[model samples]
Target: MSDDVRNIDDALSRITAYWQPHRLTSINDYDVKVVKIHGEFVWHDHPDTDELFMVLNGELIIQLRDRDVVLGPNDVFVVPRGVEHRPKADEEVHALLFEPKGTVNTGSAGGEMTSPLRELP
Candidate 1:
């Protein structure tokens, strides 16, 4: 494989659109994706794997079944699999997501927010 790689900003620029995630790098069985989020997402749960969300810019609020967690820039949260949750943001937000390869963004609940596995910048 080629050793050359691009930086995060370069990747973000290519994926300026919202909700569409651009695959970055992967470690072992996990893949890293960068996505721009806005508004609210559907409630869902991943029964097979945990998801890591790292805020890169703006802010995000993840609403669980009972409680909610607000994340700002440089903040991070881990959503355990099988727990229903939804993400919301008043303004545009940017974040880095880490999950196992083939892990659907929408998890068990399917909707328009579901994303296909895509290549990174």
Candidate 2:
């Protein structure tokens, strides 16, 4: 993407991998990412930074230690720092994540599913 206005939906459509996030852009200390995912993700938390999940398509359910927050297109939710949370989807869901630049996808729970930081095309 160029150093200009970006359309989130347009950026997401270029992704072909499930659960892999493409960095859309950076805002100060935060990075905006677009990911395509299906099924459940591991429970994790960023101890030092909050994470924002914004659904652009399909449905998503964020499973918190206490309760579940369901989301659909255009919905947004923020997971506070140090809060354990897991995200799941019954079908292919497209979403955008906002968090610090170095925040890992798996947070404290490292595994094979964790992907390296990516760049947007």
Candidate 3:
């Protein structure tokens, strides 16, 4: 991390791929990342850590085992560790994720949607 000022929207605009997270910075052992997502994501859970999701644009539905949590712009939600969850979006969504460093996009049920964190330039 540097003493640099970055525009979130401008940085988000450069992210061309969906469900792919671009690292913005790091604090302690966690990373702050931005991602563009559309369609439905794979159902999975981080066994070792809780995942935080903050919707930057559009709406998102976090599907949990018992119920679904709907999130709107500027909304924040944390899926507790070991909880099975799947994120679904009918349209495109811009969001930020805060999790431990090297947390894979796809957690335990890793499949095609898994992605290594992409660092911002």
Q: Give each model's whole-structure lDDT.
A: 0.87, 0.90, 0.92
Show pairs that collide, candidate 2. Answer: none
Return the lDDT, model 2, position 48. Answer: 90
C-alpha TM-score for every candidate:
0.93, 0.93, 0.96
Q: After TM-score superposition, what is the CA distance of residue 70 in candidate 2 from its true location, in Å? A: 0.2
Q: lDDT per residue, candidate 2, 42-106, as tens digits?
A: 99888998999999899999999999999999999999999999999999999999988888999
Judged by lDDT, which candidate is best? 3
Write down the RMSD of candidate 1 (Cα, Å).
1.5
The window of 10 residues in a row where model 3 has the poorest summed lDDT is: 1-10
Rank order (by lDDT, best first): 3, 2, 1
Off by over 4 Å in 1: none
Instruction: State candidate 1's TM-score.
Output: 0.93
Per residue, candidate 1 scores C-alpha lDDT tens digits across 3-58 of 65857778887785677777888878888889889999999999988899999999
Off by over 4 Å in 3: none
Alpha-carbon runs more than 4 Å astray in model 2: none
